[model samples]
Target: MSITVNPDWWKTLFDEVYLMTDARSVCNEDITRLEVDVICELLPIRSQSKILDLCGGHGRHSLELCARGFSCCTLLDYSQVLIDYAKARAAECNLSIEAVQSDARSTGFPDESFDHVLIMGNSLGYIKGPADSQIMSEAFRLLRPGGWFLVDVTDKSAIKRDFNPEAWHEINDDTVVCRKREIKGDTIHAREMVLNKQKGLIRDQTYAIRLYGSQTLASLLEAAGFQQVTVRTGFSPHASKGNYGFMNNRMLATGRKM
Candidate 1:
């Protein structure tokens, strides 16, 4: 089937079904711990640092950080459902985390308000064109001098090496999701369909992600006024179940405000 990518698909794509479909990776505690470990190792952070989790759906990483004694952590995402879910989880767990529902491109935060900013879970490249730069600029604006900005994304090399056109997975006994992918220039256009045993076709959507090489990402970061940009590949979430999707092989692109 031919599918046209929607620029605003993400506005509704991260609902409850998304959590169910990506449960193994996004909701997995073990994998979250491992990813948090990598984040801590890659950046110089103290327990009291003020961190911003950009596009942080349901604030998984932020919650984990709070558990680890990182006191001031704020999560921002465009989805109201995810933000509310994160807030409830934080209250239930007695973890102190601030969750905000807002666009990543222009978060209404004061200048230099964060010690570090993170874009995790392969959340970048959601829209085509220069959106990445706008997000990075916001991250730059939020970070204090000497603050670090880290991005977790699928490695372009890995995707080129193992590009699968189609895949399917059983979410459970009642539901299944099928995916079809096509590469156009630097972007991967995808169509996802979710079906239930009794409900028939529940969800069908198309989205696009612009893949970036390490050098290209670094240059973008530099253009956003970040310096000392570095990229580390081979950083996998090591998820135990569900489709890895774009998280199959990941890279960390980090930069400094100064």
Candidate 2:
């Protein structure tokens, strides 16, 4: 007899190998620190503000925010392995954070539970269909009145301007990853292969992310009942540089629940 696996690639893609690849990617501690600083400056955070790090893989930003004196920090992600890793790291650092394994599309938290919601690390566009809209709606629901929501994603504009079909990079001395990409009707399909000296060829996985322009994303946020939607390009801690137009490979969008 033959068995079939679930079609949800995200379920399997976030395993150990995925974590290793991510560690080598833009998801390192230094980047997390810079992102946290930018978030702190943009949002009206207080000592008692409840912050939800939505889709926060491994609680990097959550832990950093907690260390910076934001006490009530909750890190939520769909991957149990990542949640466990975040919990271990939080314990090791003697920091207290609520780490929950939950889907970003429909988080079970109560309405208006958070004072601020952060969706970072190009995590917004992963879901296949109207699910992205649902994610935005859920973020709107989770925030209190006047709460802030921040989202960071790859700049579709820049990607279109300079499309690279294939790229390879060394994550470490012993491991390298190659990515082949193709854009098909608003979705960027990607195939990734990880090569390791000891393990040989680790694995190959394919995934798709729906691309969005600044106006499209801002409209989505507005449709979800967000106000003061601001879209910016590039990642910078400085407000002036961060709010500039789409000139870099990454983009950021922030809104307020009013």
Candidate 3:
């Protein structure tokens, strides 16, 4: 019998220490660091504001916020490995942050628990199940009136124009990478793959993620009672796309719960 490895298995092999005091230094992985800076620019954070980093793998953002003096910073994700790494980082930094292993679709928390709920870094696409809409709805449920949620994903238009099987690349013996784009009815599909090579092929896996464009994301958030929803196309001032769904840098999505 042969076993098939997965893309998400890299986290299992690597020491995913995501949430340490020095997380920023650890996360200077170019793209990830750029994402962190962009979100901080968009958020109206204050010393007393409370924030929840949903699907906050390794608590990097949460820890950063905590360091910035947010009243309460919470990191929630279903990945225990990621959480453990985050916790280790928090301990080293001696920061008082809360990290929870919980599902984004159902946090089992009380209503209106956070002021700013963040689900970025393409986490929105990982929940490929019947409960995806439920996750968004539940995120809305966890917010108080006027709460904000920021989500990030690939631009559907970009993916449609540039996606292909040839987008994949192999970096080294320990890394095999690929990118793909597909469309399934109303939803657009974009994925990133990375493989870790072992002695032969025992160490191989892929990290696949999907994304929804502005229209679908806006409609879903609005249907869930989020008002004054705004789209940031990353390249525009005010983080607004000005009725144009096309832009660059990285997708910066911002919405408010009415």
Candidate 4:
């Protein structure tokens, strides 16, 4: 078994089974609403505001915002599966949402095209080194003057206080997902295995993501040309069903283009 992860792990990690692995927070509509509520409070905007949901998987937050009468929202994600899922959900709910498949580092949007940009659901830090900073720079370029950029990420202190090496969760009566984690500098490398009672082994994969502390994240935003950067902690969301992983404790960082 290889402990190392593919640098392109993210390209294939968020497939259908990922919905099962992360069902508790991502699939739960109530949890999505609660999270969007916090987001709306942090960056209050008018209905006509043009918003971009970067790295928005399955458009969870975008869908919730549309249902709440926040139009003019576009969701961009690298996963085609998730983008299709988002489009289907929007159509089913009779809500208007634009779902696009694209990379966060280069969304190909016009400069200063959006009034607001968001990186919700701990979608940052997927790529190590300068990739995260490039994503932030893209966000800065996409935002208009005075536009707000908000990101949700794990709180490093909480990770230090609550790091577990190995854990398992029962996805259903016959399905289980097990995880093993190792820390490498500021990055966490994880291997996940999914097993089924009837079919036996389903999936075994390894992935890695860079973790950021509050101050470091704020500084990154500032370095990306954002002004008035602020970070608010204690944005934890409780799960009523499956595992939330690093989402157990998160911090919201906000900045302005100015």
Candidate 5:
């Protein structure tokens, strides 16, 4: 018997994209009731501020901000498929949000174009290379001085303190899986064990990701020319103190161009 397998670390193993989409809808439905409040605080959205949702997959936050009277809220993503979905969502909501397909590191926007920029939903952790610096630099270039740029990412402490490098749980009645990984300089070595639950036997799969720390990320952002880098706890500072088995849950970093 043949079994499909996951090879892409956290994204493929657990594959939380659906959860992300559902989370997006939840954030939109309740507006302020979300996991990350730091984005709102750093937005500087004065009802007239021009906002750009950088790498915004489905316009969730953009749509919410628009409802709150943001002068301009544009959704920018690299995937045309996601862009199409986002545009359709905007249309369905009767909102005139601009949806564009563009790389986050090289968005084709003029200098000082937006007053506030939001890169959220743990999207910042996906980019895994030196190019991250370029993305940060581009963010600085895209916004006016003192403009807000909010980034949502996993806290380094949380990840280091809790990342189960070796573990697995049941995915279905027919499959159970576990994985292990090791970081060696610039690369990740990984392995996974999968069992066919129905057959009461073991199957196969794997996962890997290049490790990065918050300090490494901060340096990248700083070198990109962002100033006043500030980190916040939780999804939004307004969270009612939820615990994630660690002191830091998710972190939001806000930097201003100055």
Candidate 6:
């Protein structure tokens, strides 16, 4: 078996093209509101709850939570660009949110400080090797007793079953992005190319992400001292009832620190 090396492409990819490609899906006001509402239904959030948005790119979730009357919100992401953008947005909106640029594996926050933690947008597989476990451990350490930890990730089983080699998306009227994927062992290698009307070909990047099945992820969470772990599938708003199996494309994993 070959070892997986972390090139840490996220440090660069998230600067411009990433925002251009995903802004509509992640930063839209209506979508953010719906996602926040779903989270509210799943977690016991209160006005005074101290929530930490782990790996919260751009702080959309944190902003929505604060708008919903949750005063204590901290948004943490490794991308300084995204963090700075989120801070500016928060400042413009006159919302008091703490934005921190830090690695998720070691957040450096005090133990048992937050009431709830969120890791969304499938940001769990960025680090290689045992780092996933360390990320979970950090989440456990940051949450107080009875605190909820919510995670969203792509369903690896489904992706493996229906692996597509190439896909393309129109980022904007004049920009397009294409992605080609290859699965080697437990890691998925993605090569992304971006084309712009003005600049022609702009970016060509490659990255690797480890794929985790439901059982594997649950085991990691449990080993990290999280109890009552539950893994559900198909969290999209348009997903039908009972769309929560290996065939589903997305998974939502929840656990409580006790």
Model 5: which ten-residue window has the lowest total lDDT? 13-22
Evaluated with lDDT, which candidate comes out highest? 1
Cα lDDT, all candidates: 0.90, 0.81, 0.63, 0.89, 0.63, 0.83
The digit string of per-residue lDDT tens for model 6 on 1-258 reads: 333334777677777567776665675677678778978988999999999999999999999999989999999999999999999999999999999999999998999999999997778776666888999999999999999999888788877877877777787799987877888977788777899999998888887887778999899889999999999875664344322222136678899998
- Worst 10 contiguous positions by lDDT, candidate 3: 237-246
Instruction: List runs of model 2 lying over 4 Å from the truth.
Output: 1-7, 236-248
Q: Candidate 5: list runs displaced more than 4 Å.
A: 1-37, 125-128, 165-212, 234-248
Kindly report which residue pairs in candidate 2 clash with one another: none
Clashes of each: 0, 0, 6, 0, 6, 0
Would you list the rank order by lDDT, best first? 1, 4, 6, 2, 3, 5
lDDT (0-100) at residue 193 of candidate 2?
Answer: 90
lDDT of 2 by residue, 33-152 (tens): 887888887899998999999998888899999998899999999999989998999999999999999999888999999999998877866666688899999999999999999988
lDDT comparison, 2 vs 5, better candidate: 2
For candidate 3, give the lDDT of residue 143: 85
- TM-score of each prediction: 0.96, 0.90, 0.74, 0.96, 0.70, 0.91
**What's the C-alpha lDDT at position 188 in model 3?**
42
After superposition, the stretches of candidate 6 with alpha carbons farther than 4 Å from their true spots are 1-6, 238-248
Tell me model 2's lDDT, rounded to 2 decimals.
Answer: 0.81
Candidate 1 displacement at residue 44 in angstroms: 1.5
**Candidate scoring better on TM-score of 3 and 4:** 4
Candidate 3 segments whose C-alpha is farther than 4 A from its true place: 1-26, 29-33, 167-198, 202-209, 235-249
Candidate 6 lDDT: 0.83
Q: How far is candidate 5 from the true structure (C-alpha RMSD, Å)?
A: 6.1
Model 1 TM-score relative to the real fold: 0.96
RMSD of every candidate to native, in Å, equals: 1.4, 4.9, 6.5, 1.6, 6.1, 3.6
Mind giving the per-residue lDDT tens digits that candidate 1 earns over 99-166?
A: 99999999999999999999998998887668889999999999999999999999988887788889
